[model samples]
Target: MKAKTQRLYLVLGALVALGGAGALAFSTLGDKATYFYAPSDLAGKAAPVEAIRLGGMVEKGSLVKTGETVRFVVTDNVETRQVTYTGILPDLFREGQGVIAEGHIDPASGVFTAETVLAKHDEKYMPPEVAGAMRKVEGKVS
Candidate 1:
C-alpha cells in the first residue's frame, strides 16, 4: 500500500475500534439509564423490565404513612399512579408538589418499584428527578 493509504487504513482501524468500544459501553450502561415519566406514561406506555422515571405531583391527602414506609399517588393531567416506598421521604416532598421516581415497571401489577425517588428543591432549581416530578405535576405541556 502507498504511504498515505497505509496511514488512512490505520486511522480507519482506530476509528472502528473506538466505535466498538463506545457501543459496548453504551450497551452496558443502557440498562442503568433512568428515564423520567409522567403518571400517564407509567400507566400507559412503559413495558416490563424497562427502567424509567416517574414524575408528578404528590397527591394531597394521599400520602399514607406506615412506619418507615410511605405510600402516595402521583398524578398527571391524564392519569394518576400509586407508589409504595419503604424509606424516608425528602423534606421537600409533600402533597401537591413535584416528585420523580426511578425504577423499573412491574407489568403484572402495573406499579413501579423505585430504587430512588427524586424530590424537587425549589421553584426555579430542580434536580433531574425533581424536574421529572415537576413535569408530572404540571401534566399538560404549556
Candidate 2:
C-alpha cells in the first residue's frame, strides 16, 4: 500500500476511536448530572421528574421534625418551596441557613423529596449558585 494511503487509514482509525470515547463520556456524565435551581425558578413550572439540586435559604419558622424525617421550606424571598428529607441531616443544617437539597419534586404535591441535604460548609461560605440567585432576587426587589 502507498505510504499516504497508510497514513490516511491510521488517521481515520484515530478519529473513530476519539469519537467513540467522546460519546461514552457524555452518556456517563449525563446520567449523573443534576440541574440546579432556586425556589423562584420552580414557581409556576412543571415539576421535574428527574433528580435536581434546589438551593436557597431555609425559611425561618418552617422546620418541622417527625421521627427520622424533617420537612422545611426553602425560599429566595421571591418564592418558596417545601422540601421533605429523611435520615440524618447535616450538623450545620438549620433554619435561616443556605442549603442545597438533591432530589425530585412530587408533581402531584409540589413537595421536594430530597435524598441528600447539604448545608453551608461555614458561617461565611455560600454556594456560588445560591449566592447568585439571592442577588438576582434582591435586585428585583430593589
Q: On residues 1-142, what C-alpha lDDT tens digit does candidate 1 reach at each position?
A: 7999999999999999999999999999986876667776555564646677777777889988999878788876558888878787878888887788777667777766666777887776556654554565565666
Q: Give the range where candidate 2 is weakest over 10 consecutive residues by summed lDDT.
A: 41-50
Q: In model 1, which runs have C-alpha deviations exceeding 4 angstroms? A: 1-5, 44-47, 125-142
* Residue range 1-142, candidate 2, lDDT tens digits: 9999999999999999999999999999999999999998899999987899999999999999999999999999899999999999999999999999999999989999999999998999988889999999899889
Candidate 2: regions farther than 4 A off: none
Pairs that collide in candidate 1 are 35-53, 36-53, 37-53, 99-133
Q: State candidate 2's TM-score.
A: 0.92
Supply the global lDDT for candidate 2: 0.95
Residue-level lDDT for 113 in candidate 1: 69
RMSD of each: 3.4, 1.4
* Shift in Å, residue 86, candidate 2: 0.5
Q: What is the lDDT of candidate 1?
A: 0.75
